[model samples]
Target: MPTPDATRFTVLDLLDLNLNEQNALNLRCIGGRKGLSREITVPDLNRPGLALSGFYESFAWQRLQIFGRGENAYLKMLAESSNVEIYDKLFSYPIPCCIFTHNLAPSKEFFDAAERGDCPILQTDLSSSEFSSRVLRVLLDIFAPQTTIHGVLVEVYGIGILLTGDSGVGKSETALELIERGHRLVADDVVDIRCVNGSVLMGQGANKVIGHHMEIRGLGIINITHLFGVGAIRDKKQIQLVCGLEEWDANKVYDRIGTEEMTTEILGVHIPKLEIPVKPGRNIPIIIETAAMNERLKKMGYHSAKEFNQNVLRWLESENARALYFNRDDFL
Candidate 1:
């Protein structure tokens, strides 16, 4: 599901985004202040090159119309014709905004048309290609499917392992130990998982304020950053493996051989899952670290369980062939 606030995204939010260097859009309002509240419903951009030539068929008016150098020149040519009717027709559609890259500015007549239609006109210092890539990235993340999961997300052996199970099942405790072992903690209690690019599950804290804090049974609440320093915390990580910490059940027939792989679905993506039973002296952190390494091995096409089973089958086949040869009438 798209984020609740994604539907309400406006041109104002794009201007107000807190982006860092390289990803910063450097966008500013150049005209049509009344249209700043216009909602951006799409994650794509339109060049408006063909639209400027009066070819309105299949015109993507819903997207952010980009006016690069070529489009700006065309608009200038249209302005010289003493015809403002084309600009009015362009603004008649409920376009989110018109963004001019390379810090390009439209003519006075263009701005007048935008003001009449209440369509915001934005400008950026970045080039057309750079601005298009940056804006599309930000919009994809905003429109990605997101859900809040009650679990602790941590990185073990450079692999993101999500600790999930019933409450008080030692999920947080296991993550705390993993953190003590020098692994990074992504999120403690509430993990906001977003499915990016339709396959990768990116996990981070739901709330930035309480992200690095963990709630222990006896210790109440503790700040992980202060306890372990900033090197032990991560802002976000891709969830590669899921380790379900459940109370050790004697009757449950757990897979001892590890031959049959198990997986669980989160946001339509199937992630490799391991149900690690929790009990005294189990050393859950070590098991998770090992599981992370094993997952890496599996990704490299080396499955330990399958390899061992193949070796055993080879030995059994050889022994059976020798016995049958020795039991033949001529050999006896």
Candidate 2:
């Protein structure tokens, strides 16, 4: 996993990001254009209602300030009263920026205070709650814990499977076969993974320059999209299962019954794992595909291994009962 950094992003970077329309915050600069370069270090947002009320004891001025309808109205009241003390106190801190929700216009005093403080003032058409939720979601994703792993990630049967092993373990080769079988390849060689919502593991390519490109020992670097079209490539995927390939060990006993489920933890999230032994003739790609399908079945509450064990027990019981009955009839 990549180490966390004290990354800082400017208000202009946030504005320039091309988020999907459904999750867009619709932010636009209304005033304090000179402060657009202010840094937004934290992902959390702050409501300045208390600050506007002159409660500066525990003000979170470092956060991106949010001014909803109530805060806007209070600012108007403060403007009418010619109360400049609260604004001065609030703007004294290095506030990153102020956002007005519901497309609310800022009062002249509020704009003047932002300009003087060099804090950017932004507006959004979304309601206060909607804007808050959208901005928070985006920020959480941006600030999520990230790491890079040497593996190949692919989507097989709608399940994201991460294949890992030592060098020349054929991780990319298996992924190529999976793609040939109509599955989608997420990343090759260097898989960039992030912890989303503290429970989900999201994987993508580490570098966009060589994204969807795989390096096979004999074939060199190949572009999956160009060879297999767009359907064979995916930008990102939620990693659900991890498959570890190892050189065949004759002395080691592999799980043949599949009765025991194994898991590997990444960033505090445990993901289902399968260790497949590699051999001269073993079909690694097919095994991975079956593993992915079985994982999906388990998610749907149908565990193949458990079901197989139950069926075996039921059959044994029936055979035992029949044998006992036949023996009793012979005795009679």
Candidate 3:
């Protein structure tokens, strides 16, 4: 099942007094102006506070006064003072603002000061590294969700297959074979994939009939559309399958039957998958085409292995019946 889009909680969203109290066991947001309090609080790993001019001048100076001249305590004092000063500056910037804090809890003094027009406080359950990763991913997904990549995509026997592997993995070779078999080629060499409607993955070729050409190591590049005619190309295809080519490992046990289904995940959607081991004399293109046909058969409710096994069992039962219930004298 597709997971819901990662819910992003801003400083303002989490700052609600009611929601804060509800999830208080997990998170605690305190202080900030009550009436004008919906301030933006995002978890930013970039030390926005450190960049502020004179951040060390105000809070750092106060902490030194409170603790006096203790040289060993300076590091602890500096960290705490910087966090406070950062929060102070973030609150004054804009409503929807965020700053990151680590390890140390906000002191009562800081929270009390924040209550008097200070910024919203956000606590994260993730470790420093983990929180940074999650925050960056959410930000990237929300702000920039699309990217273009160069690859090949094909549709065989009604199943859309995307072929991707190392530079010399024969992706284009296999696509060419499928096209020769009368199946349409969707995209070749450079396929553009986009996640539209959050669930469906649509793939198309680049400009200049990217779906109409194929490249071979010895032959260089050949145009399938011109040679094989217009029936050889497709405008676009839904990505129903993904085949990742990897160097075959002798020690690794690979799936040999279709009883279990394997899937490849793209943009959080799981598409049917198959691992075709590569080796000298192996007809990988034929294997992929057969796999697509098999998938189509499965969709039509026909299973060759299951049917053959059932027939074998029935034949054995007939032999047993002859041994158990038949009489030689009756036949005579």
Candidate 4:
């Protein structure tokens, strides 16, 4: 679900990305240096076995090409058979690049053809499966669906909460209070949200220049990390709950019991949501804290509202039975 702009990443950018040390693929330029500037516009990868076998009908030229052990063996066979036309047809398209996994090197003829076509060739020490899985994960993240929202994302008791409301509706103030109460702030104001793996919604600061900073109307801009230290701020967090704040509406009937669960959808992912009516006396931060804890409880299969309802029903049934028995005794 990536946008066109997000898919404009080049091979040079991929090589230069500061990926996690544990998940690093140890990639390096093996050949075809001129094609390093070539753009990779998709998160998918293709194994060119069919193309190497002279079948190029539905070849996926846009995706990054992977040459694993099988493909390398076939390339050698093609070379032995003196079949050079497949290579010519393969490199004719604007393919992003070719990656050799497990340090597998290509034939001299293949290298010569790639150089002629100006296609970048990358090498990695990881096995074919390992390299493919790692690359796919990184590409999926880069190409995930993303959006920017005006809200505050915070982690309270290990729960990710996204607070949203109209401008000047105390969203920042509530987050400040939570930070004071030993919670971590992910992002304030403009929150950049991304849907990862088609299920989880991750949130971070939209602007890195002003990350972990909040703007209060009267106080202007304030840095949360400087005032509260590193423990108060985080880079990103998964949004598990959405809390919408609004001015107290007396006419609207709010959910007094927790049975009626509400949700908000973002990028096709439905997240639990709550509408909190802000008032002068209500402690918004504390309420949010309780809501987070309650959400955790619900995840653990304990629903307070449902339990209360069951208890009320049991009490009503017992009373009705006692009344009927007493009336029968009186009639006898």
Please identify which of the two predictions, 1 or 2, would achieve the higher lDDT against the true structure.
1
RMSD of each: 2.5, 3.1, 15.6, 3.1
Clashes of 4: 0
Local distance difference test values of all predictions, in order: 0.91, 0.88, 0.58, 0.90
Residue-level lDDT of model 4, residues 199-315, one tens digit each, is 999999876677899998889999999999999999889999999999999999988997999999998999999999999999999999999999999999999999999999999
Task: Rank candidates, lDDT, best first.
Answer: 1, 4, 2, 3
lDDT of 4: 0.90
Better of 2 and 4 by lDDT: 4
Q: Among these predicted structures, which one has the highest TM-score?
A: 1
Writing each residue's lDDT as its tens digit, candidate 1 over 1-332 gives 23336559888888888788978999999999999999998889999988878889999998999999999998998899968799999999989999999999999999999999999999999999999999999889888888889899999888999999999999888889888999999998889999999999999998777789999999999999999999999999999999888999999988788989999999999999999998998999999999999999999999999999999999999877887788676545
TM-score of each: 0.92, 0.88, 0.48, 0.87
Per-residue CA lDDT of model 3 for 1-332, tens digit only, reads 01122343344443332322323313344345352334223333343333333454332211101111131134246455654564355345433322233433545544554565444545545344554555554433333334344567888888888887888877777778778888888787777666655777777776553447778899988888888889888877888778776568899888875666788777777788877777778888888888888878877998766777788899998877776668645544
lDDT (Cα, tens digit) per residue for candidate 2, span 1-332 = 12233366788877876677878989999998999888888888999888888778888887889999999898888888998778878888999999999899977887888899888889999999998898988888878887789999999999999999999988989999999999999999899888999999999987677799999998999999899999999989999999999999999999999989899999889998999999889999999989988998999999999999999999999987887888777545
Backbone clash count, each prediction separately: 0, 1, 7, 0
Instruction: Say which prediction, candidate 2 or candidate 4, comes out ahead on TM-score.
Output: 2
The list of candidate 4 runs beyond 4 A from truth reads 1-7, 73-86, 104-112, 327-332
The local lDDT score (0 to 100) that residue 283 gets in candidate 2 is 97
Candidate 1 — what's its lDDT? 0.91
Which regions of candidate 3 deviate over 4 angstroms?
1-150, 209-211, 305-332
Position 96, candidate 1: lDDT:
95
